[model samples]
Target chain A: MIEVRNVSYEYIKNSPVLDDISMTFERGKTYAIFGPSGCGKTTLLSLLGALDAPTSGAVLFDGKDIAQIGDENHRKDNVAFIFQNYNLIEYMTAAENVSLTEKIDPLPYLLQVGLTEDEAKRPVLKLSGGQQQRVAIARALASDAPVILADEPTGNLDEDTAAEITKLLCDVAHENNKCVIIVSHSAAVAEAVDQVVRLSHGKLQEEV
Target chain B: MSIFKRAWTYVSRTRKKTASLCAMMCVMLLLSLVGIMLHGVCMDASQNLKEVLGGYVRLTYSASNDREESVLDEALAAQIAALDGVADYSGISTYYLSAPDVQLVAGSFAGQPQGQVPRFVGCDKSALHENFIYNSFEVIEGRHITSADEHCAVVSDVFANLNGFTVGDRFEACLDSVITQDEAMPEEVYSLEIVGIYTIHEGWEITPMTPERDIAENFIFTDMQTADAVLLAEHGVEKPFYRQGVIFTLNDAERLPEIARSMQNMDGIDWENFELVVNDKAYRDSAASLQMLEKLSLLLVIITFSLSGILLALVLTLWIRERRHEIGILMSLGISKVSIWKQFLLETAIIALVAMVVAMTLSVPCSRMLSEKAFDVAETMAQSQAEEVHDPMADVMEKLNPTADAAVDVVQKDDVHLTFAACITIVLCTAGIITISVTLSAVPMFRMKPKEILSDVN
Candidate 1:
C-alpha cells in the first residue's frame, strides 16, 4: 500500500499545487485520480512516483516514508511510470524497451500486452499509436516494481485503443497483485477503475 | 541495458550526428597535429642554422683606448676556449715583412712597385683562419701551422711556385727592414721554415692598385708565438702581446651573446680597453627568416588550439541540446544523471578516437609538405636579401682577425621529422579539448531535474 499523509506541494512560494492532500492506494487494485486540467492530480501522482519532493508532509510506501527509501531507489524498485505519448525510447526496439529494467524476459510481457513477436522486435517509433501504447504497457508490466503510475497513458490514442490500454492496466493490477494509479481527466477512464478520487483546487473533493 | 550498449546504440543509429561530430573532431585534431609538427620543425631548423653559421667572438685589447689594457694571457685563452659552446679559438697577430731572396706573387694587375711587401699572418691555428672558413684558400700540400710550430710559415702555391719553394724549405724574412728601414739594427733576418703550401681562390684582387700585402698569394701563415718573438726582437715587447687579440669560435652563434655576457663577468677583465666583438651578420639574412618562421609557427599553434576548443564546444553544445529528450527518457527510467553522462562521454570518446586516428594518418605527410614549403620560402627570402645586405666591414674584420667573424654559408636543406614529444603534446591537447568541451556542453543538461526534463519533452 502507498499512502499520502497531508502532502502539500507548491510550484511557487505562496501558491499550492497540492495542499495537504491525503490518499491511500492498496495492492491488487486499480485507482484513478480524476480531476480537471489544473486540479494537481498529476502533481500528487509525481509525488507518489518519487519524481519530485512535496512542499510539506510525507508520502510513505508500506508505512515507511518514501524519502527514507531514497527517491532513486523508490523509483527504480517500487514504481514504474507510464507517461502520455507512450514515452518509449525511440532508438530501441519494443522488446529492448520492455527489457530495459533487465529484470524479466520481455517477450512474455510484450505478448501479454497484445503485440506480436514481429512487432516486439521492431523499433517502437515504427509502431502505430495503439501498438506503441501496448509497448509502454509491456515495459511497465515487465518491471519488478510493485506500483505502476500512469499519467494520461492513453491521451494520444483513439477511443478503442484507450479502452484497451486502460483494461491492460487493470489486468496488471489484479493479475500481478500490484498497485496501479492512473491520473486522468476523462470520466470514461475513471468508470473502469476500482476507485475514483475526484480532486479540485489541490484537494480531494469526493471519492467513489 | 548497460550504459555502453545504450551509448553504442545511439552512436550507430544516429548516423548523421555521429558523422558530423567525427568530421568536426577530425578537422580540429588535424590542424592541431600539423601545427605542433610545424612548430617543432621551425625550432629544429633554428638550432641547425645556428650550428651551421658558426659565429665567433673576438676579444681585443686596444692600447689607444682610455681604459686599462686587459692583456690576454695563456691562462685566459684557455679559460675562454673552455667556455660552453666554444668550438675552437685562435690567437692571431698580423705583420708585414719582405723576403728579399724570395719572389712574391703580384696582383692580377700590379700597379705600384711599393706593393712588394707580403703579409705574414700569425695564428695559433691556421686551419681556423677566415681564408679557410670562407673557402678563400685551401691547403693543397703539406700541413697547416699550429701553436707547436716555431718560425714556420704556409705560403701560397703561386708564391711557392715563383720561388721554387717546397715544404721543409727555409726562407729569410726581415720585419725591421720593412718597419724601420734600419740597416743598422743588425739586419735581424729570421729563417722561417715552410711547413705548408695553399692554393688561393679567384677574385682575391680587389683592384689594380691592390698592394702585395693585400694579395691572397702574398699572404703567409705562421704561428702567433713566432710573430711575438719577432715583435719583441724589433720593438722589445713581451709575450702574450697579441696585436689582433684572440677570437673564440662558437659551436652555435645564437649563444654568442650569452657567452659574451659570461666572458665579461669573468674575473680581472678591463671593461674600457677590452672589447668583445660578436660577428654573426653574415648569417643574419638566413637566421632572421628562420626566427620569423618560428614565431609564426608558434602563433599558428596558439590559433589552432583556441579555434579548435571553441569549435568543439559549440558543436557539442548543440549535440547535447538535441538529445535532451533522450536524456529525459533515460532519467525517467530510473537511470541516474551520472549514468546518462557516462553514455554521452562514451559516445564522444568513440568519435574522438576515430577522428584522432584519421588526423594522425593525415598529419605526417601534410606537416612535411607544409614545413618544406615554409623552408623554401625562408630560403628564397634569405637569398634575395643577402644580395642586398653585403657588409664590407665584417669582411675587413675577417681579414684582420681571421678566426673572428668568418662568413658562414646558410644551410640550404632541412628535413622535418615528427618527434615523440610533439606527438604526446598533441594527444594531450586533443584529449583536454574534448574533455572540457563535453563538460561545458553537459552543464545545462545536468542542472535540470528529471521532472523538468520529462515535462519539457514533447
Candidate 2:
C-alpha cells in the first residue's frame, strides 16, 4: 500500500504542477488517476513511485516514509514504473528487457503478455508499439515489488489493445494482491480500474 | 539479469559501435607503443656512446705558451684526478731514446740512420694508454708495464723483432738530442728490461720529415718512476714532472663539458699556463641526436595519450548521452545508478581489452617502422643543426683519436627493440587511461536523478 500526504511540486517559482494532493493505493485493488495533459497526473504517479521527491510533503509506503526507506531502495523493493513511451532498452531483446528487473527467465511473462516465443526473442526495437508496451508491462510484472506505477500504460496503443492492457493491469491487482496505479486520460482505462481519481487544478478528488 | 550479461548483450549486439571504438583505441595505442620503443632505443644508444667515447680530458701546457719546458707537476695531476667525474688519471711524459747498441727498426728515408730514436712514454698504468684503449695496440707477449714495474718496458713487436729481443732482455739507451739538445747527457745511460711485447693495429703516416719515434711501432711504454728516475739522473731535475699533461678519464661521457668547465674554474691549476682539452665532441654530437629523439618521443607519448583519453571520453560521453532513455528505463526498473555504471564500465572494458590485445599483436612491426622513421627525422634535424654549427676542431680531434669515429658509427647503427618491460608499461598505462576516461564519462550521468534523466526523452 502507498499514500501521498499533501504533496506539492513546482517546476518553477510560483508555478505548481502538483499542489496539496493526497491519495492512497491499497493492495488487491487498481487505481487510475485521470486528467487532461499538463494536469500533473504523471507527476503524482512519479511521486508515489519514489522517482521524484515531493518539494513539500511526504510519500509513504506501508506506513513508513519512502524517504526513510531511501529513494533507490524503495524503488527497487516496493515500486516498479512503466513509462508512457514504452521506454524499453532498444539493444535488448523483448525477453531481455522483461528480465531487466530480475534474473529469472522472461519467456513466461512475455507469453502472458500475448507475445509469441519468436517475438519475445526479437530485439525490443523491432517490436510494434503495442508489443513494446507489452514488454514494458511484462518488465513491471517480473519485478517482486508490491506496487506498480504506470504512466499512460496504453496511451500509444489501439482501442482494443488499450482495453486488453487495462484488463491485464486489473487482473494483476486482483489475482496477485498487488497495488496498481495508472495515470491516463483514457476513459476506458479509468472505467476498468477498481477506483477512479480525477486530478484538476493541481488537486485530486475521487470520482465516487 | 546480471551486469556482465547486460553489458555483453549491448557490446555483442551493437556491433558497429563496438568496432568503431576498437579501431580508434588501436590507433592511439599503436602511437604510444611506438613512442615507448623509440624512447628505449635512444636511451640504449646514449649508454653505448658513453662506453665508446670514454671521456678523456687532457690537461697540460699549451703548445703556444711562451714558457718553454713548463712542468705539469704531480700535485696538479693529483688535484685534477680527485675532481668529480674523474674516473682515473695518468701522467704521460715521453723521452726520445737512441739505443746505439741495438738494431732498431729503420726509418722511411733511405739516407737516415739505420736505427732511429724511439719514444719512451711513461704512465702510471700502461694498460690505460689511449692506443690500447682504442684497440690500436694489444700486448701479444708478456705482461703490460703496470705501476709496480720500476725498470720494465713494453716494446712494439716490430721493434722487438728488428733487435732480436725477447722478454727479460736488457737494453741501454742514451737520452736522444731531440729533448735534451741544449743540455749535456749524463755519463751513465738508463737501462731497462723488456717486460711486454705489443702489436700495432694502426700506425702513423710515413713522410720524409716524419721521425721514427713518431711511428706507432717505435713507441715504448714504461712506468712513471722509470721516466722520473731518468729525468733525475740525466737532467738533475729534483721534482717529478709531466712534460705531456695528465689525461683524466671520466666516469660519464655526457658530463664531459660540465666537468671541463668546472676544471677550468678550479683554484689550484693555473689556467693561463695549461689548456684543458675535453674530448666530448663525438659524444656531444651523437647525444644531441639521441636527446632530440627522446624529447620527440616524449611529446608523441603525451599528445597521443592525452588525445586518446579525450577522444575516448568524448566518444563514451556521446554514447551515454544517446542512451539516456535506456538509462532512465533501467533506473525505473529499480536498477541502482551503481549497477548501471558497472554495466557501462563492463561494456567499455570488454572493448578496450580486445583493442589492447589487437594493438599488442600488431605492435612489433608497427614499432619498428615508426621508430625507424622517427630516428631518421631526429637525425635529419641533428645533422642540419650540426652543419650550421660546424666544429673544425672535431676533425682534428678525430684524427688524434680514431675512437671517436668508431663511436659515431656504433651509435648510428644502433637498433630499437621492444622489450617485455616496455610492453608491460604500455599495458598498465593504457588500462589506467581507459579507466580514467570511463570514470570521467560515467560520473556526471550517475550524479543526476532518475526523474531528470527520464524527462530528457532523448
Candidate 3:
C-alpha cells in the first residue's frame, strides 16, 4: 500500500499547487484520480512515483516515507509510470521501448500487453496511437513494481482502445497484486477502476 | 539493460550523428600526427648535421704568413691536442703553383713549371679516416696519398684534365723566376709526379666566394714534407713556420672561448694577430626552429581543444534539450539519473573511438605529405645559403662522416613512430574535450523535475 500524509507541494515560495491532502491507495486495487485541468492530478502522480518531493508531507511506500527510502532506489524497485501521448522513444523498436523498464525478458510482457512479436519489433514511431499506448503499458508492467502511476494513460486513444487500456490496468491491479493509480479527467476511465478519488482546488475527496 | 547493450543501441540508432563526430575526430587526429612526424624529422636532421659538422669549429689560417711561423707549430698543436675534450687536431697549409711542362696543357696555369703546390697537413691518418674526411675522395684512377708517400700527391680530375697528365706521369719545368727590374722577380718552382686522380661528387662540391672556383679542379694534395720543400726552394726558408690562425675541433664547441682564452695566454705567442671563431650557427638555427615548433604545437593544441569543446558543447546542448521528453519518461519509469548520464556518455565515447581509429589510419599519408613539405623548404633554404658562401658541396662532403651516417639509420624508424603517437594523443585529447562538454550539458537535466520535462509534451 502507498500512503500520503498531510502532503503539500509548491512550485514557488508561497505558491502551493497541492494543499494539505492525505490519501491511501491499497494493494491489489485500481484507483483513479479524477479532476479538472490544473487540479494537481499530475502533480500527485509525480509525487507518488517519487519523481519529486513534497513541500511538507510524507509519501510512504509500505510504511516508509519514499523520500527517506532514497529516490533512485525507490523508483528502481517500487514504482513504474505510464505517460499520456505514448512517450515511447522514437528511435527504438516497440520491444526495445518496453524493455527500458524490465530487469528480465520484455518480450513476454509485450505479448501480455497484446503486442504481436513482429509488431513489437517495429519502431515505436511507426506504431499507431493505440499500439503505442499498449507498448507504454507493457513497459510499466514489465518493471514488476508494486505500484504503477499513470497520467492520462488513454488520453490519445479512441474509445475502444481506451476501454482495452483501462481493462488491462484493472487486470494488472487485481490479478497481479499491484496498486495502480490512474490520473485522468475521463469519467469512463474513472468508472472502470475499483476505486475513484475526486480532486478539486488542490484538495482530494473520496467519490461515492 | 547492460551498459554495453545500451551503448550499442544508441550507436547503431544514431548513425548520422556518430559518423559526423567521427569525421571531425579523424581530422584532428591527422593534424596531430603530421605535426608530430615533422617534429621528429626536423630533430633527427638537426642532430645529424651537428654530428657531421664536428661540433661547430672552423679551421682557418692567414695566407701571408710562412708555414714555420704560423700557429700550426708542433708545440701549439700539441697544446690544443691535449686540451680537455679535444677530439682531434690537424694543421693544414695549402698554396697554388704551376705544373711542369710535360704535364702542363697549353692554357693551364699560364704555362709555368708544374709547381708542386703542396699543402702541409699535419694530422693523424687514423683519425682522418675514422671521421670519413678522406673517405669522401673517390679515387677514379690510382690510390689515395698516404703518410708513407711524403713526396707523392693526389691530383683532382679537373687538375688532371687541364694539365694533360695521367697517373705515374713524371714532368719537369723551370723553377727560374723572371726578374722585372722595376717590379717584382719570378719565384722558383718544382716538378712532381701525379700518383692519383680523384673526383668529388656533385653534392659534395663547395661553393667558393668566387662562384666559378671549383676546389676539385684547382687544388693538389701532398704531405707536409713536400709542402716544406717547395716553400724552401721558392722562398728560401730553412726552418718550418706557420700562418697566424689555427682551427681546433673539440668535443664541445661551447667550451671554445675558454679553450681559446687558455691558448691566448700561452707563453711566447702573439694573441692580437689571431682570433678564434666557433661555427655555432647551425646549432643556433636548429635550436630556434625547435623552440618555434614547441610554441606552435602548444598553440595548436590549445586552439584544437577550444574549438572542439565549443562545437561539442553546442551539439550536446541541442541534443540533450531535444531529449527532455525522453528524460522525463525514463525517470518516471524508474531509470536512475546516473544511468541516464552514463548512457549519454557511452554514446559519445563510442563515436569518438570510431573517429580516432579512422583518423589514425588516414594520418599515414597526411603525415608523410607534411614531412616532405617541411624537408623541401629546408633543402631549398640550405641550397640558397650554400650558393652564397664557399663551396657548399665541399663543406657538406667534409662533414658527411660516420656519426651522421649512423644517425640517419635511427631517424627513419623513430620519426614514423613519433608521428603515430602524436595522432593518438590528439584523438584522446579530443575525446576528453567531448566528455567534459557533454557532462556540463547534462548537469541541468539532473535538476529538472519529471513534470517540468513532461509539461512541454502536454
Give the clash total for candidate 1. 0
The per-candidate TM-score of the B chain, in the order shown, comes to 0.66, 0.71, 0.64
Q: What are the iRMS values of all candidates?
A: 1.4, 1.1, 1.7
Model 1, span B1-458: residue lDDT tens: 88888889888988988998999899888888888888887787677667655677888875556323456666778887887888998887888766667787665424433455688888989987766654467899999999898989999998999999999999988765556577777656778899999997533326665667777778899988778877777777665566777878888787788988888888766667778887766456667877888888899999988999898888888888888887777777777777877888889989988898898889889988898788778777775676565555554334343221222133335566667887788778777776777777777876776677778877
What tens-digit string does per-residue lDDT give for candidate 2 at A72-182?
A: 899889997888888889988999888887888999988987889999999988999989999999898888888989989998788987898889989988999999999
* Native contact fraction, candidates in order: 0.48, 0.84, 0.66
How well is each residue in B77-108 modelled by candidate 2, as lDDT tens digits?
Answer: 88878888988878887766666776655565
Per-prediction TM-score to the true structure, in the order listed: 0.74, 0.77, 0.77
Worst lDDT run of 10 residues, candidate 3 chain B, spans B117-126
Residue A158 miss distance in model 3 (angstroms): 3.1
User: Which clashing pairs does model 2 show?
Assistant: none
Runs with alpha carbons beyond 4 Å of true place in candidate 3: B53-55, B59-70, B73-122, B125-270, B282-298, B379-424, B456-458
Error of 3 at B61 (Å): 4.7
The C-alpha stretches of model 1 lying farther than 4 A from their native spots are A11-15, A103-105, A155-167, A185-192, A205-208, B59-76, B82-87, B91-246, B251-255, B261-276, B282-287, B392-414
lDDT of each: 0.79, 0.80, 0.65
Q: lDDT score, residue B79, model 2?
A: 82
Residue B193, candidate 2: C-alpha displacement in angstroms: 13
DockQ of each: 0.44, 0.65, 0.58
* Candidate 3 lDDT for residue A195: 89
